[model samples]
Each structure stands twice: as C-alpha cells, then as structure tokens.
Target: MPDIYRALGDSTRRRILSMLKQGNKTQKEIVDAFDISQPAIKKHLTILLEERMISERLNGKYRIYSLNLSILQTAYQEMLHYIGELLDEQLISLKNYVEKGEFRDEDD
Candidate 1:
C-alpha cells in the first residue's frame, strides 16, 4: 500500500520498525535509542501508527508499541511481486531482442 511505502521512506522510521521487530517497546524506550529529540521520534512513530505498521496500547502511564507483522509481511510480499514482474518484463524484452538479432555486442 502507498501508506506502507510512505512509512518506509524514511531511515528513522525504518530503524524504529527494526527496533519494534525485536520486541515491543515503550515510547520512552524508543525515544532513548536515538539521538534525536523525543518529539522527532514521536513524529516517526505517528507515521508508523497511521500506516498500521505498528500498534499502540496504553499500559498505565506508558504507551507500548509493537510491530504489526502481518501488515508488514503483506506489504513486503507485494513489493517483491512487483519487483519480480518488472524483472520478468525486462527479461522478456531481452529475449525478444535476441530473437530478432538486434542485440549488439560491444566487443564486436
């Protein structure tokens, strides 16, 4: 989904996801891992939350966030499929070119 791609577009957000992949973490815990300000990290978390890449739960005074693996897996699979289709198209074009004797060898 476009949301997933957008959520993954930033290195900071990707790192946050990688952290969540290890285990659930509190907002403070996530904030501590990076050198950036808490508000900056919070913004990245918000985007991840909006994309449903992470889920949040209130625990007393703390909010815990965890990766939503199913959503991530679905997005990853779809991206792989898209990449495979592109590669397949390129290969088909190369095959056609060769078949028509139109491919050139620079060494020749």
Candidate 2:
C-alpha cells in the first residue's frame, strides 16, 4: 500500500523494520540500537505504526514493538501482482511479434 511505501521510503524506518524482524524490542532497546535521538526513533516508530507496518503492545510500563508481518506479506503480494502484469504485457507483445513473423531468431 502507499502508506507502507511511504513509511519504507525512509532509511531509518527501514532499519527499524529490520531490527523488529529480528524480534520485538522495547522502546529503549530500539533507541539503543540506533545513534539517533530517542525522539527521532519514536517519530519513526510512530510512522511505522500509522502505516500498520509495525505494532505495539504494553508490557507493564514498557511498550514492545514488533513487525506486522501480515502487512509486509500484503505488500509482497502487491509487488508480485504488479510484476505479473508487466510480464503479461511483455508476453503479449512477444506473441504479436511472432504472429507477424517479425521475431527472427539469431539461429535462423
């Protein structure tokens, strides 16, 4: 989805996603993983949450962040669909060229 793409467009967000992929992490743990300020990390996490790319659960007073794998799966499916469409068009063009006898093989 566009939201996912927008959220992933930033390197910081992408890195955060990679970090979450390893396992869920607390806000402090996430902040420690990066050289960025805690506020900046929180901002990235907020965007990821808004895009549904990540989810948060409260563990007592701590907030644990985890990757929303389903959201990523959806994005992967969309990409596959787009690639299929492109391949279909190319195949159709090849078919047309062959029917017109315009596609001559080098071996021929």
Candidate 3:
C-alpha cells in the first residue's frame, strides 16, 4: 500500500483531494484553482496518484481526476485506529502513574 501519510503531508495535495471530493476535474481546472505553476500542481497530482488516493483518466486531450473514495475511506479508518491505540497507551500510562502516587498534592 502507498504511504497515505506521505501523500497527505503537503497542503497542495490536500487541497487537490478536497477539490476532487466535490467532483471530477481536469488538470487545467485544478491548476487554475492555485496560484502555483502547472508543473507544481502536476507534482501534487502525481503523489496523489501514487498513493492511490485519486484516479486519473485521459479525457480527450485533458486528464480528468477523481477521488478514489474506497482507498481514502480505508486510510481514514486506519488513521482512526492508529490514533485510538496512541490514546489507549497514554491512558494506561496515566492510570499507572496515578496508582503509583507519583503526583504530589498542590498543598504539599
């Protein structure tokens, strides 16, 4: 599986994903939304494609891109599970610390 985290690390890539979520768009349309050059937008689109977060098809002379909902949903669930695991670990640590009486009273 592609590293969805790496693909999502950039703001431009996130914005491109958001745009596709609304509906499919051509490369020109996507580039027009940002002030950056077409080459920069192309780079972002390539990352999204590599991560399988979006799909691209040749629509005549233009390439149309659409959000890959299933892949994105799977990534979202994985992220949630990962975050839950971290929270659980922190809670367990807090519980152990409290049980050990490591924290002193403010008056003390």
Candidate 4:
C-alpha cells in the first residue's frame, strides 16, 4: 500500500499508468507519447513496475507494458475501506454530539 502511494505520488508515473490502462503499449510508443526523454520515461516505468501497478513483457525486441488490473482493483478497495472508516468515525462523533444536545434553537 505504501508502495502504491509512492508510485502514484509522481505525476509522470501517474500519466504512464493512465496510458497503460488504455491498453498495452511498446516502450517506444510510451516514450513518444510523452515530451520527456526516453530515459525519463523509463525511470517512471521502473517505479510503476516496482509497485506492481504495471507489468511488462518482451514482444520480440520491444518491451510492452500493460496495466495490472488486479493491483488497481486492490488499491481501489483499500481506498474505499479507509474512506468508510473515516466516515464511520465522523458519524459516531455526530451522533454523540446530537445526543448531548449541543444544537439549540435560538428561541430555546
């Protein structure tokens, strides 16, 4: 999870992941899509690969990258769980405040 957050922290890497989500793309295709140098793109790809956000395979001499849907799905689920916990905490606080009669009408 920490790895996921780290990988997603970079805008370049995020764009790389987004591009891969459309479909598998060759290293050249990815490099061409970005304005940065090939080496720069390669570095971003490396981080994404390390985080398991994307997978790569050799198609002949070219390296093709694709999104790892399972990992993204896991990340999505984890985010939902964290959000639910936060909402639950807020709701409990609200309930307690209401029960304590913290809110009062001006006429009261």
lDDT of 1 by residue, 15-57 (tens): 9999998999999999999999999999999999898999999
TM-score of 4: 0.87
Poorest 10 consecutive residues by lDDT, candidate 3: 1-10
| Top of the candidates by lDDT | 3
Residue range 1-108, candidate 3, lDDT tens digits: 667899899999999989998999999999999999999999999999999999999978999999998999899999998899999999999999999999999999
Best by TM-score: 3
TM-score of each: 0.91, 0.79, 0.94, 0.87
Error of 2 at 99 (Å): 4.3
Provide the lowest-lDDT 10-residue window in model 4: 1-10
Compared with the true structure, what per-residue lDDT tens digits does model 2 show for residues 1-108? 636678889999999889988999999999998999999999999999988899999999999999888988998798788889999999999999889998678998
Off by over 4 Å in 2: 97-108
Lowest lDDT 10-residue stretch of candidate 1: 1-10
RMSD of 4: 1.7
Report lDDT per candidate.
0.92, 0.90, 0.94, 0.90
Q: CA shift at 105, candidate 4, in angstroms?
A: 3.5
Backbone Cα, N, C clashes tallied per candidate: 0, 0, 0, 0
